[model samples]
Every structure is written in C-alpha cells, then in structure tokens.
Target: MSFFVSDRAPANRVSGYKRRIVLYCLGALLLLLVAVAMGAAIGETAIPLDVIGKTVANRIFGAGYTLDPIEEGIVWSYRISRAIVAASCGAALAVSGAVLQSLLRNPLADPYLLGLSAGASTGAVLVTVIGIGGGMVSLSVGAFWGAALAFGLVALLAKAAGGGVSAQGTGQIILAGIAGSQLFNALTSFIITRSANAEQARGIMFWLLGNLSGVRWDDVWLAVPVAVGGVAVCIWHMRALDAFAFGADSAASLGIPVRRVQVVLIAITALMTAVMVSLVGSIGFVGLVIPHAARFLVGVRHGRLLPVTALTGAVFLVIADIVSRTAIPGQVVPIGVITALVGAPGFALILIRGRRMR
Candidate 1:
C-alpha cells in the first residue's frame, strides 16, 4: 500500500500542475474579453458593453441591431481597430520576449534589446523625413527593411565577437545589440533633425513614442498574420526551447540543432517585432514585462508559457491603451509612456526579488 501511495502521489502532482495551467489559461481568456470590452466602452463618449457586443455581432453576423452613425464609427472604426492592434502587438512582443529570454538564457532579454525597434524607427524616419522610398514605398516597408538590416548587423557583430548564437555567446550578442541600438537610434535622430521640418519632426516624435490613435483595419490585418504565425512557430519549437533552457550544450546532447534553432527563433522574433513596430511604433516594456509576469503565472515550459504570455500581454496592452486614452481628459497619452511608467517599477521589483532569491 505504501509503495503504491508514492507512485500515486507523483501522478497526482502532475495532474494538479496540468490542471492549474489550464485554469490559468482559461482565466486569461476571460480577462482578455473583459479588457477588450472595457477598452471599447471607456472612451470620451462611453458605449455600453452590450452595445459593443451587438455592434460586433451586427458587423460580423448581420444581427438585427443598430447604433447611431457616431456610435457605430466609434465602436467599429476607432476603438475596435485600436483594441485589436494593441492586443496583437502586445502578444507579439511578449512572445518575442519569452523566446529571447530562453534563447539567450537571460531573463532580461527582450525584442528591442536586439535593436529591431531602433532599426524600424530609422526606416520610418527616413521614409517620412527624406522620402527615400519616394511615393511608391510605404513607411511600413521602410520599417521592415530597417528591422531586417538591424538584425543582420547584430548577428554579424555577435558572430565577430566569438559568440555567434551559441549559448556561450549570449553576452556578446547583448553587447552587439546595444551597439546596434545606439547606432541606429542616433541615425534616426539625425534623420529627423536634419531632414524633417518642425511640424514633420513633431509628428515623427509622436509616432516614435507609440501612438495607437490612428490604427485602422489595414494595420490590424498586417499585424494579425505575423503575430499568429510567429506564435505558431514558437509553439512548434517548444521542445527545442525547453532544451535550450539547460544551455546549448545540453540541447545539442539532446539531439537539438542548436545553431539552426537559435537562428530560426531569432528571425521569427525579429519579424514579429518589425511588423508590430511598423504598425504601432516603439511601444516598449510589453515585451520586457509581460513575459516575466506570464512566466511567473505559468512557469517556464514554453507549452504553458507562450499561450499564457500572449493572453496576458493582450489584456495588459488593451488596459494600458485604455488608460492612455482616458488618463488625461481631452488628450491621449502615448501608449509607450504609459507602459514605461508601469513597467519600469515592475521590472525593478523583479530584479530586486531575483537578487534576493540568489
């Protein structure tokens, strides 16, 4: 009886762990819905949650419900688009963060740390200020190219520094990323200062600080596929990610293609970051903070971590966007500002607690 009890205890513990993960995921989904509803309902002119539901239903399923033109425009055009973009961007950034932390073996690693955002900013600034792409190429295209370029340079520098995406090379990669970020950021500033007029520079500055007010269905469509695809790729590589947690040598011994997996995951993260940055500018800290919070809630296994991270990120950004719009009457704060204000303190707390644990 005692021997059977030991086996049963282990099985019971495993079951309990799985049950908790499922419960957390379910809770996250519910919170995401509530966040979306709250985002739609809390603007200058409030629309009830019921109206938001009806509006969405009517638009999607031809339900027999209606609203005034202004209300319809607010719900369908402005708020919904903003909410969707926020959710998508949040999820993309957070997942990128989670992957990077595992891939780099550094909990502090985030998407922007690799200079993607800076490169994207430089691209957008060039397009807006100097019209480098002429009228044919769009800002989004410029940003994507910028992000790709930045990633290439970072990888090059990291390789040159003797790390080259191996587990032992994480520190070199971080250093390269820092150098690239500074260089690109300076280039962005130079472009804005030298080429953009006062008014144009102001607009670029606003965009760089992260504005979601102008997001539309077009932006949402551009973001959703990239976000979904990147996340799916991450999930497919979950076992590889778990292996990497024990270091590249461990992963290799486990028959993982360490170098190839690292490159692929990094590329996926860069693509996700590029699309989101192009759509919403550089909204920081969602990547840095959300993944950490999700990891705390769901543990480190990518199987549980990724989905919960995505859901938490979406809900967090939606709520953040809502606060950005409503925090100051008659003026919308930049979403980046709000995130920084919230994330900086939370991150510091994480660092403090992490140090204490040591």
Candidate 2:
C-alpha cells in the first residue's frame, strides 16, 4: 500500500514512529472511553461516573449492581443512546471532513462545501414537509436521497466544467459546491416557507441548526452502518486521498484512479452526511473544524489520521454536548450552534496560519 502514513520516517527511525503511533492511538482510545463515560454521566439528572460505569457494565453483562427501572431507563434509554449518538455523529463528520479536505485538496472542503449537507437536507425536508416516515428511519431515508442528489449534481457539474469526470482545481470544485449548496438551500427554504404549519417550519429550522436531543437506539442503528461503511471506504482509498493532496494529475500519474475513487468517496461521504444530518440536523463546524484539529494531533497519515480524526471528533462532540446542556441553567443549546461558535474562530486561525506559512 503506497498510501501516505502521515508519519513516514526512514527505516532506521521506524521504532520511534511506531512508538509514537501506538501511543497516539492509545491516547485517542483513552479519550474516547473517557468522553463516553463523561457524556453518559452528565445529563440533567446527573448520574455519577461510578453509577454510569455500573450502568454500562450492567447493561453489557448483567454483572453490576442493578438500579430501579427509572434509573435504568435514564441510563440505558437516555444517556447511553445520547452518548452513542454524540460519538457516532462526531466521528462520522470528522472523518468525512478529513477525507473531503484531502480528496478536494483544499483545507476548507467539508460536507457543506461539497453541498452534501444541503442536498441531504433537501431530501429530508421534502419528506418532512410532504410527510415521509412517521419515525426516524423515514427521515433518514429522505435525508439520504437529498444528500445523494446534491452530491450527484455537484459531481456532474464538476465533470462538465472539466470536460469529463476528472479532478479540477480546488477553486472549481469549491465554487461548484457553493453553487449547488445555494440552490439546494434555497429549495429547502422554499419548502419551509410554503409549509402550512408553524411547527413544521420550526422543525425544519432546528434541523438545519442541528441537535442530538431525543436520540434513540433507532437513530444509532441508522447512523452506525453508514459511518462504519464510510470509514472502510476511506481506508481502502487512503492512497487516493494522499494522491489527491498533490493535485489530480499527480494522483493520476501515480495510478491512483482519480475519477473512480473520487466518485466512490463522494458517494460514501454523501451517504454518511445524509445519515448524520437526518439524525442531528446540520452540524456545521464539525466537518469544518475537527479534521484540522485532529490533523494537528496525528500529523497527516490517512491510516493514523483516519482513526484519530474519528476519535477526536467523537471527543469534541461529546464535550460540546456536555457544554450545550450544562452551560446554562434550565436551558440547552443546540449542539450544532455550540460547535459553530467553537469551530469558526479556530478555523479562521488555521487559515491565517496557513497564509502566514506561505
């Protein structure tokens, strides 16, 4: 596998690199475990860490001290599901962002930048306004189709601009993505405006802003498959992502199979985006910010970057959820809102740093 490992020291330096990778992976794993525990422990009712651990153990193996039905329900039904949702969505968005930045060869590439979120929102909005499923599955399906359409349109437009399905410059793709996003976003707004119910309008608006409240195990089932599949696809095409970083022609010359891989990645990303957005509306800075943060931690190897990005994303989302719920008394902010506030400034800093480096 001629893929970039992000940390590629010479053979003589292999031992040191190996140690670093192991430690990094271990640290990320520890962070994930802590985040999960902490996320489960900090809801409105406030389960202690020991209780949280006991609840998890009981749920997993029936070996720990048992709680009453109410406590069990809170732990099993509310906190665990919520924590899982946070971890899954965060990991999915972060990895998606990382893959997108590499694939687009632009630091700013994200689900929104590629119109996947908007497209998925369009589909989801269609079902919501028109009435799709009575439940989460129906919503997820609608969002999936919306994302597919958005990404499909962007891909087609990019192809047309370059005279074929080839990787154009970052500028072309980003511009095309922006155009696609605007078109879909407009369509979504139109749908909301035409809706007869005020509640529906509010729902649509909240969905766009993103939230992880009311998460159920059903949402977990819907999100996990898509996230896992997308991660697998990214791993398989790690080399292609690296090739893309050097530019399309360079990737092609290196036998990276640019167009085919590009299509595959876009499809994977679109599906994952739809799943995520449907479950938790349009969480913005996650895809934009977490990848860069994780990259700084893990260097830039896709093998390492892919996993670490996912882990950091999970941690970031969990912490964000904690703050969203606990930052104010008797009030909970939307997770997406918190992430954007946190992400946007740091993202700007990254851009400034990039410019300075140049």
Candidate 3:
C-alpha cells in the first residue's frame, strides 16, 4: 500500500484553516462577553456583577431572581443597552474601516471616507438648528438621510469625474469624498454659527463629538441588527476585499466584478457608518484607528483581519465608553474625546511602525 502524502498535506492544511477559524471565533466571543460585562458592571454607579448576571438572566431568560428593582432596572434598562450599542457601533465602524482600507488601499480610509460624517452632521444641524423638519424628524433620522444624500453625491462626483474603478479612479473617489466633505462640513458650520443659539449650538456640538448617554433598548435594537448584517455581508465578500486590495485589474482578472463589488461594499459600509452615526453621533478615531491595529496584529489577509478588527474595536469602544463616563468624577466626557485621546497616540504609533517597516 502506498502512502498518499499529497492527500495528507492538503487535508492537514484544511484542518489547520478550520482550526484557526474556530479558535478566532471562540476567542473573540469570550473577550466580547467579558468586555460587555465589564461595561455593565462598572460605571458612575457600580452594579454588582452577580446582580448584572442575574438581571440579564431574569430579563432575557426569565430566570426568577429576587433582585432589587432599582438594580435590575439599571442593569436591564440603561447599562446593558448602552454596552450593547457601544459594542455594535464599534464593531460596525471598525469593520467598515477594514473594508474601506482593503478596497481603497489607503491606510487612512475609514467609514467617513465618503463624507458620511460631514453629511450627517449637516443633517443633524438642519434638523436641530434650522428646524428643517419642523420637529417632525428626530436628529437620528435627519442625520441618516443626510448621510445617504452625501453617499449619493460622492458616488455621482466620482463617476462624473471620469474614474470608474481603476487605480486612478481610487484617487478620484477619495478626492470626490474630500470635496463633498468640505461642502457639507461648511454647511454645518454655517448653520450653527448663523442660526443656532448657544444652547442649540452646544447640544449639536456635543452630539457631533459623540455622546452615548441617551442610548437605550431601542438603540440596541437598531444598532445590533445593522452591525450583524453589515459584518455578515463583508465576511461573505472576503475574497473580493482581498482582491480589491491588490488592484482593480487584478480583481477583474480574478473574475471579481470590480465595479459591482466596489459599489455594493461601499454602500454597505456607508449604511453601517450612517446608522452608527445616527445612533451615537459622529464618533471619531474608531474607524481610522481600529483597522490599522487589526492589520498590524493579523497581517493583510482579510479573512482573519476583519473579525479581529471588529472584536478589537468592540472591546476598545466599550472600554472607551467606560473611560468617558469615569474619567472625571460626576462629569461624563464625550465618548469622542476619549477615543481621540487614545487614537491620536495610536495613530502616531502606527505611523512610526509603518515607517520602520518601510
């Protein structure tokens, strides 16, 4: 009997791949659970871990636990919801960043690359400052529509500028996004400067800087589904992301429809970014910082990179949220502020590492 060495090698490789995937999934799940638990248990008012666990069981599984109504209410109503939204938002933005980076081949590419943040800010300002919706639309709805409008404008600009999906076209899209961002940002500033009262200006500014104070169960419901779907879509197209990272010509040669994949993935990322921005305001640093961190750890293969990036981001933002609440006693800093504080330094480190690698 001859030993089939060739077959053994292929089978072994397949086994290793499956093992890596399983290990990654389990590790990510464990860390995420721990981070969520930490966020729920530690805050301005600390809730006991047992109480939180019991409250979650009672609320989610109908576990009969004789717990304080106040503790249960806090756990079920505010903290848990906030933690869930933070995780969802962080995961969405980070995955969007990773996808954009791979697709655009720009280390700096982020969910806001297509002017979503600027547009959302302008839209929120329009609703709050200009009263465009006349109290009919909430800030979240206005911001979301604004983001959608911005995405459309950017796409039109990129196409009209004569860059389809070539390497040159990648730069074209980035330029178009920059121009659109400037226009919307200017509009937001103008409205705030000319129309908004001090209180209104303050409120919009805080929201634009990112605030999770108002996150509730409704937000969790909205954010969780969007995050899950967007991430699933990205994972499903993992091959396309890797292909795009090489070049459009290469992706096309590989039978990947370059333009279609580009458009669909960008739209999905925009939706993820827009929804998260709507829920939590325009949180910065997450989309820009998390992907690079993930890439540094996992290398360039998107199959491994995407999920690690998302989990890292989820944990990072949950921790950031905790810091924002606890950094200054009795005063909740903007979540954006905490992220910026960490991200700016992290960005510098990434640059240093990149230069060294070069």
- Give candidate 2's whole-model lDDT: 0.80
lDDT of 3 by residue, 1-358 (tens): 2479876988999999999879878988999999999999998899889999999899889999999998888888988899999999999999999998888888888888899999999989999888887899999999999999998999889988987445457888898899999999999999999999999999999999999999999888899999999999998899988888778888899999888888788889999999999889988989999999988898888888888888999999999999999999999899999999999999999999899999
lDDT of each: 0.90, 0.80, 0.91
Q: Identify the runs in model 2 with alpha carbons over 4 angstroms from their true place.
A: 1-23, 132-137, 163-165, 169-172
Task: Report lDDT (Cα) of residue 264, candidate 1.
Answer: 90
Evaluation by TM-score, superior candidate among 2 and 3: 3
Model 1 C-alpha lDDT per residue in residues 66-117, reported as the tens digit of each score = 5776887799899988898899899999999999999998888999989999
Question: Candidate 1 regions off by >4 Å?
Answer: 1-27
- Model 1: per-residue Cα lDDT at residue 63: 93
Q: What lDDT is obtained when candidate 3 is compared to the true structure?
A: 0.91
Candidate 2 local lDDT, 1-358, one digit each (tens): 3544544546638888889878987887788888988888886778777777677778888876867668777877887788888888898888889988888777777877778889888888888887766555576678878887887787778767773245664566677889999999999888888873798887777777877776899988877787777888888888778777788899989988787887788678777777788788889888888888877776787877888788888889989989988988788788888998899998998878767978
Indicate the worst ten consecutive residues by lDDT in candidate 2.
Answer: 1-10
Best by lDDT: 3
Name the candidate, 1 or 2, with the larger lDDT value: 1
Q: Pick the candidate with the highest TM-score.
A: 3
